[model samples]
Target: MAIKFTPIPTTTAESWRNGGTDAHGQKPERRISDGRAPCRHCLKNVPEGDAVLLGAYKPFDAAGAFTETGPIFICEKPCKRFQGGTNEVPPVIAQRDQFLIRGYSADEKIDYRTGQIAKVSDLVSQAEKIFALEDVSFIHVRSAAYSCFTTRIDRAR
Candidate 1:
């Protein structure tokens, strides 16, 4: 199976940049990047000294007990959304040490059996394995240390 690393939609990111409220109904907090945080839309590190928008984002469209809302960083300036071949891991995320990988069903509910803390080196293979499961419709990569949202993965067409 070919899996693609998917970033949040550009429209959603644009909304935030245009003074939209976050998931908690609050404005996105602007902060200076330390060069370690990746903008969820571009899947690249927000450069040091660049302004970042910190806010809560729910990666799913569904509202349910298993749906999670978590923190994410977005570049305050315009950035092209990440575009890569199927099964290619974004460079910024690939440089990370580890991340929490979990599969979600079609309904957007977490499938606990697919949860694991995976090394960056194993992300592609691990995601492929999870995609092999029948119930898994997608996967979400999150910071293992902070539990913040990173990126979403889906079986490529």
Candidate 2:
């Protein structure tokens, strides 16, 4: 199955400019390094010999008063989209890490419905269950620890 990874929205730049803070007003700045950190998209730590750029990204579409976005880097080398299913949920997802997965209702509202997957391994099963719901349109996987978004998955129409 081919899954298209959505590009981080431009609004994230503003969020970054505002100090890379989330809705909770917590600021999580990138490590100040002469070098670069890993690109979350490609799951690769940036090599010290390569170049990196500071950019803002909104993992989600802007629609509310408290929407969040942040700063990230664009790798010189393009990264491939993640194609793995449950098997590739990532080890980080399951290590007692607090995360949030929101499932949208049909009306495009918050749905007041959300799932908390403590670990990465639980994400796939939780996502599968959420996707199975007829009313859910998509899901926003976020890190509750830092309130940063990991990724968004739109149900296949």
Candidate 3:
């Protein structure tokens, strides 16, 4: 199956910034009322009655100095799909508040140190430096506040 990424909504971003946590612990998965749907990563509300599931995921990998993968509920429903093409990163990502874009090498080590981007246009140039790494498979765009995975870029097929 092809890899796909969905944009996180703005409202969810606000909630996470304000302070929220998954009340339920690991193992015993929890389900919330459809009316209260929220994206585990961005902490934004999923539209009323949207289907959501609580599952574990590692935003980072296991056994690393910064391995940060964890449980998150992605939209079980289709919203918008993003594929890295045309060398353009979406405006939503470029304009996000307090974001850090980092490129990882094939060994998953952070390539050029991550930097803060004030606008979306900066991503293309910033990404160019890391894109050349031989083992780089993906780029992680994340929120600095929670260090949450906002989106990932993969080789376009």
Candidate 4:
């Protein structure tokens, strides 16, 4: 029943850093972090006054109705990707009091029944319950307030 909390792939982040366009097909906006912005690649909050790349990111490979593109932040400079204990929530995500959790099927369709807003402490347990369902293939952790993409969670093999 192990679960892996994953950051955005480094290759993708590097692409963005190397002048790649966002989901909107436009250059990513560079901004100064307000400390609340978390880098999706590093799974850590970008400190206040530091540079960040704000852009639209589509987390799925498929292009369909179920596929969603949303705003995300990443460090303007390179940072180490997150490597942490399986089944533990990333600190950047846990820093928030609550988050939206949803499950997606193997075909990349949303499983409406698996969506909920969970307290940080309850996140792991809730994700476990979602993973219990046969239809659920992966989970997305999102900001409860802004509904921005935070990180992804996958059932460990």
Candidate 5:
């Protein structure tokens, strides 16, 4: 299976940024970057001087215990969506020493044995190894240090 790195969709991000609501359907919590969070839309760190939104987000559309709503960062203003090459590690992942990668089943439940902390440099191959399995439906890349949702990786159609 060919892998594709997917960032948060721009439309959803725009709705949240424009104050439609967060995943919780409440106004998104806004804050200034302290240098740790990255805007999932752009797949880039929210530079120290910029504004950002801190809000709960569910990576999967499925609504169950496995559907987690965790804190995620987004630009206070709109930015271009990440368009990194397929199977390539985005700058957000590549700039870090390591990040967490984990697989999920078709039902969106976590696949226990597929979770691993991957070196940024080796991320693509690591993802390929996991996707090689028939049971794996999709994978998520998260900030290893804090385990926040970064993006999803899916097999290219």
Candidate 6:
């Protein structure tokens, strides 16, 4: 099966750059990259000298146990959104040592026993295995240490 890696939605990203409030409806903190920040749109590291907006992100609509705010870094300047392709891991994630991947059900609820902290080398196989499960609606990639939102994954159409 093919896989799709999705970044934060473009509109949401634009809001952050346009000086609009974040998902929490508060102005995001403007900051420079420590060079570790993964700009969701480009799915690449924002260079050390690049600008970014650090703010809270909840990757879902309905507020519930599964829905909670966490930090995410976005480009301070507008850029194209990532359109995930098959057989490729974005550089931002590929360069990392480990990541947290979790499965969600059709209703967008977390699927039990479906989360794993995977090594970068194992991400592809791990994501493939998760997608093989029929009950999993989608998957989310996050920082294993900080659990910060990174990106979303789905079966590629």
Candidate 4 residue 59 Cα shift, in angstroms, is: 0.4
TM-score of each: 0.97, 0.57, 0.54, 0.97, 0.93, 0.95
Score candidate 6 by TM-score against the native.
Answer: 0.95
Position 68, candidate 5: lDDT:
74
Off by over 4 Å in 5: none
Candidate 1 lDDT, tens digit per residue, 72-152?
A: 999999999999898888977987899999999999988888999999999999999998899999999999998888999
Q: Candidates 2 and 5: which is better by lDDT?
A: 5
Q: What does candidate 3 score on TM?
A: 0.54
In model 6, the worst 10-residue window by lDDT is: 79-88
Candidate 4 C-alpha error for residue 75, in Å: 0.4
Per-residue lDDT tens digits for candidate 2, residues 14-124, read 444445554345554444434435354543445666654455455545555435556555344444434445335532233334577777765454545566654555665
lDDT of 4 by residue, 14-85 (tens): 999999999999999999999988999989999999999999999999899988899999999999999878
- Assess the local accuracy of residue 1 in candidate 2 as a C-alpha lDDT between 0 and 100: 23
lDDT of 3 by residue, 7-103 (tens): 4443333333333333233432345436544454333555566655554445544468655664455444444434334565554454454467776
| RMSD values, in order shown | 0.8, 6.4, 8.3, 0.8, 1.4, 1.1
| Residue ranges of candidate 2 with Cα displaced over 4 Å | 1-40, 43-51, 85-87, 90-98, 106-108
> Which portions of model 3 miss their true places by more than 4 Å?
1-45, 59-62, 78-81, 88-95, 115-118, 132-137, 155-157
Candidate with better TM-score, 3 vs 5: 5
User: Least lDDT summed over 10 consecutive residues: which range in candidate 4?
Assistant: 87-96
lDDT score for candidate 6 against the true structure: 0.87
Candidate 6 structure quality by residue, lDDT tens digits, 1-157: 7787888888888888888897778999999998888998889999898899988888987878888688888888887777656858998998999999999987789887789999989887888899888999889999999888899988888
Q: How accurate is candidate 3 locally (lDDT)?
A: 0.51
